[model samples]
Target: MLFKREFKRNLRSLIIWSIIIAGIILLYLSIFPSMAKEQANMDNLMNAVPSGMQKAFGMDRLSLGTLLGFYGIEIHLMTTLLGSIFAALLASGIVAKEQNEKTAEFLLALPISRQTIIAQKGAAVAANVALFNLVIVAASLIGFQFSSAQTLSYKAFFLLELAVFMMHLTFAAVAFLFSAVARRTRSIVSMSLGLVFIMYFLSVVAGISDKLSWLKYVSPFKYADAAQILTEQSFRPLYAVVMAVVIIGCFFAAYGYYRNKDIVV
Candidate 1:
């Protein structure tokens, strides 16, 4: 019953997200292909770009003319950021809303077992994520259809998005765990956003500094490297396994915490 209600709420919220996100995708596909044309024909684009700009944007190995390179290096950041923001909002709200609405006690009054509650809520979150991923995949395929002078494989980009999708799942887990424990909805939402950006910054720092390279393993961003997924056609399977474990561990831990706690009236 708890999961069903939560899913209903979330599914309604997703409608707005879908409309806004579709607009963003259409915007990206419209402009970038045109800009990419100029960059492709110009050999000096790389040379004229400042070193700081190249390093800051990680444009060293990618060419604007190539759809794979341009998308991974330039266009995908917006998509990635939007995805993280959506996951954070969905996850942070999922558990916290129960307490915020003063519904926790009523929810607990139902005969449903705590474990089933956790399982179903997790399923609800997972379903939400899967739906958005389908959107991204659909948008990518549609975008590819309209591009000319660009030889690109939709399968390759979709695989990169898959790595990103997994990391977003882990992000949702982190946010859901925080929401379960937090005293207030505002704190849960803010901390969830902080966690997402912190991990991304850590990954960027690790990319720049050899001394801090080990920090990359501590972030979900490592498993979703746009360049690596686009160029190598590979993402770290071991890291994906670790992220899956962490996500499961978080939800189970949340269930343990939820079961033992007494809800305040």
Candidate 2:
């Protein structure tokens, strides 16, 4: 019952975000052929851009001439950042919104345990995230069908999507932890956005500065970097492990804290 309610409540926002992200992806892909035609000019334009800028944008190892490269350098940023923002927003508000709306007392009076509540909310989040990825992946494949670039590499594309999904899960876990401990829905929303943007900034800076390259380890964005994924066509085992650890740690911590948190009527 709780899972159904949560999922239904979040369904509208999920659809809106899916459309926005997929639309942007399709729009950018439509421009690929035009850019491909100007390949020489595009290369010249890229050459003129600073190396630091290229690296910051994940364009250092990719080209605008090829479809996959274009998708890697162009669409990957939008998909990851926007999809993560959606995940974070959804997870961050699922719990705290009850208190913000003065419904927490009502919810607490129910027969369900806090553990059950968290589990239901987490399941809703998981379902929503999975659905969002499915929509985006379907949209991407459709876009590829119309592109002039050679046949799409399904293995590499799916691997990239998997990384993207993992990134979304990581951000959602962090936001879920925030929702568990924080009462103000407004604050949780702000923190969720701030966390994602800050981590993204760290990733860009890490790419630009050798001295701070270690910062990549701290940013979730680095775990699924488009350049690295496209080049290697595989996720680094270490990154996967780190993300898994963070996801598990955050969920466990959220459960432990919320189970004992004092609720005000």
Per-candidate TM-scores read 0.90, 0.96
Runs with alpha carbons beyond 4 Å of true place in candidate 1: 40-43, 46-56
Query: Residue 24 error for model 1, in Å?
Result: 1.7
Residue pairs with backbone overlap in model 2: none
Q: What ranges in model 2 sit over 4 Å off?
A: none
Q: Mind giving the per-residue lDDT tens digits that candidate 1 earns over 98-152?
A: 7889987787778988777767887888888878877877876677656766787
In model 2, which range of ten residues has the least summed lDDT? 145-154
What would the per-residue lDDT of candidate 2 be over residues 1-265, giving only the tens digit for each residue?
8999899999899989989988998898877877888989988998899998888777789888888888988898889999999999999999899988888888888899999988888889989999999988998888886674466567888888888998999999999999999999899999999999999999999989989999999998888888888778888889989888988898889888989999776
